[model samples]
Target: MKIGLYFGTFNPVHIGHLILANHMAEHSDLDQIWMVVTPHNPHKNKSTLLDDFHRLHMVHLATEDFAKIKPSDIEFKLAQPNYTVNTLVHLEEKYAHHTFSLLMGEDNLKSLHKWKNYDVILQNHDIYVYPRLEAKGPNREAISSEQENVALKNHPKIHLIDAPVVEISSTFIRNNIKEGKNIRPLVPAKVWEYLDHNLFYKK
Candidate 1:
């Protein structure tokens, strides 16, 4: 099986995530899209993240109806401060028959060189990148070619996909929920129901 790993915190899976994953599965050569729920990311502040189980369940709810997409808790058993390269290696060892590729936004591509063993990752797996609209904010830092590893952009293993630009983010939904605003439309029906019933992110 040709699987595409779409890794994220998914504090609360939103419609944007589902749309992108569906697009990748339908439009790309991948046979399946595994939404890998990270238990702990080295680059993120873990304090703000929801419980790993809760986030994974939300992803399950969001992708239940999608035939080609499914939630993955593979990272939960891995060591803390999980790195992509480590996970890829583990997956390869466990599922030798299944080929794995990476699905990421263009913005993440800019910083791919900074990831642990990025060279090894590039050499072993293909990368499918989707477009991301520039975030407009005072805190946003502009990325220049000078700051990026230009070789990565032109790597033979890199594939630039024409997926839709989804601006919705988990942080946005979480903030809205904290403000007592309805984020029903931003997430799947089942996910919204779960969040509402549990009063998640309302604190």
Candidate 2:
């Protein structure tokens, strides 16, 4: 089986996540999409993050109806400050029968060189890159940032997929939910119910 690992904190899975994962599952040659829930993203602030299991359960609710996209807590048991290279090695050893690839946005591709043992990651797995629109905000200018990584972008193993540019983000959803706004349309019905019942991100 060819599994595409879509790693994220998922902080709370939303429509944007589902859309992209579904697109990859249907459009790409990948046999399955593993929405790996990272316990700790080195780049993110841990204080704002919800409990690992809370975030994981929300992913479960969000993807329960999608057969091809499943939630994975593979990183929770690993050492903190999770790194992509290590997870790939672990999965390779455990699921040697399954071939694994990475599912990432073009922006992440630009910064790929900075990841730990990024060379090893590229050598062993193919990367499926999707289009992502940078949100224009204060002191931020929106441009075609995807075109910045010329060298990596042209790699033989890197595939630039024509997936839709989903602009929605977990930060956007969390801010609205805290303000008592209806985010029903932004998340799966079951996921919305789960978040609401638990009063998540409402503080």
TM-score winner: 1
10 residues in a row with least lDDT, candidate 1: 135-144
TM-score for each of the candidates: 0.91, 0.90
Model 2: how large is the Cα RMSD against the reference?
A: 3.3
Question: lDDT by residue for model 1 over 144-181, one digit each (tens)?
Answer: 35224457657899898989888899999999999999
Model 2 misplaced stretches (Cα beyond 4 Å):
41-45, 135-150
True-vs-predicted CA distance for residue 6, candidate 2, Å: 0.3
lDDT of 2 by residue, 109-130 (tens): 7778888998888888999988
Clashes of each: 0, 0
TM-score of structure candidate 2: 0.90
